[model samples]
Target: MFLDRDGTMIDEVGYLDRREDVRWFPWTIDAVRLLNRAGYLVCVVTNQGGIGLGLFDEPFVHGLHAWLDATLHESGAVVDGWFLCPHHPRAVAAEMRGPCACRKPGRGMIDAACARWDIDLTRSWVVGDRDIDVMMAVAVGARGILVRTGHGERDLRKVDLSLPAGTPVVMDLMEATVLILAEGERRT
Candidate 1:
């Protein structure tokens, strides 16, 4: 499964830079463990414009990720990998200052993960808290689930009309995981 990090795993702290500021969402570890047990890769795909906008550097992002990983490990949930797009069209960085395909609403990161991990996109899932996450899943032929955490509840109104009819929107990660697992069991 591909998951969005900010707003999805951690609270939406508006481009969080410091490890001290990391506020992980409730039930994150248990939800991740459930997906992992269900044979999902549990990778993270996130957009960090703060890096490209000079609000924070790549090292800061990495440091925060490292801290997150360590914390998850302590809780018996491990993230498989993280794919981030640091570019923003309006605000560019000196090095990261260009249009890149790794951003969400684009399928570069998802495609790259599929290639590297031999993921079956058609059978995989994307869980996020934004419309961009839905667009990413649509681009890659995966199922997109919007969780009402972070910015999701607020962003729901902005969702487009093209999503599959009756696509489920859950309250949080744990509930989403339960639904996904139940659906998987039904299919079997």
Candidate 2:
């Protein structure tokens, strides 16, 4: 599974830099556990433009992810991998500046994860609260699910017609997981 970090797994706090700011949404751990049990790899694909914009740094993002991993470990859940893009078109730092393929709406991060992990994109699912998440999935033949959390409700209003037809939209990750598991059973 390809999941979005902010909004999907964790509550959207806009540029979460501090560990204390990390807040897991209700049922997040349980939902992830469900995916883990269902044999999903649970890879996180996030676009952290705050790093490029100078709101935070890469170390802050890594530290926050580390904290999240430890917290999930306490619950016996595991995140197989984390893929982040810290670049923006108008970044302050030269290295972080310029449009990048790794950013969402681009397939760089997803492609990297697939190559590194040998993921089967056709059998994968992308869960997130943004249109870009759906776009990413569509680009790589993965199913896309939009959850109405974080910026989801707002993003829903702005979702263009580019998304694949019949893309599932759920209340949150927990509900999305249920749907995914059920669909998997039906397919088998």
- RMSD per model, one decimal: 1.7, 1.2
Question: On residues 60-176, what C-alpha lDDT tens digit does candidate 1 reach at each position?
Answer: 888778888889999889788888888876666455766678888899888878777888888888898887888798889988998889988988776454556666788987888
Candidate 1 has a TM-score of 0.93
Question: Tens digit of lDDT per residue, candidate 2, span 74-187?
Answer: 999999988899998889878898678899978888888878888888889999999899999988889999999998899878746465789999999999999999999999
Task: Find the candidate with the highest lDDT and give its number.
Answer: 2
In lDDT terms, how accurate is model 1?
A: 0.84
Cα distance off (Å), candidate 1, residue 31: 0.5
Q: Pick the candidate with the highest TM-score.
A: 2
- After superposing candidate 2 on the true structure, give the runs of residues whose Cα lies further than 4 Å from its correct spot: 159-161
Q: lDDT per model, in order?
A: 0.84, 0.90
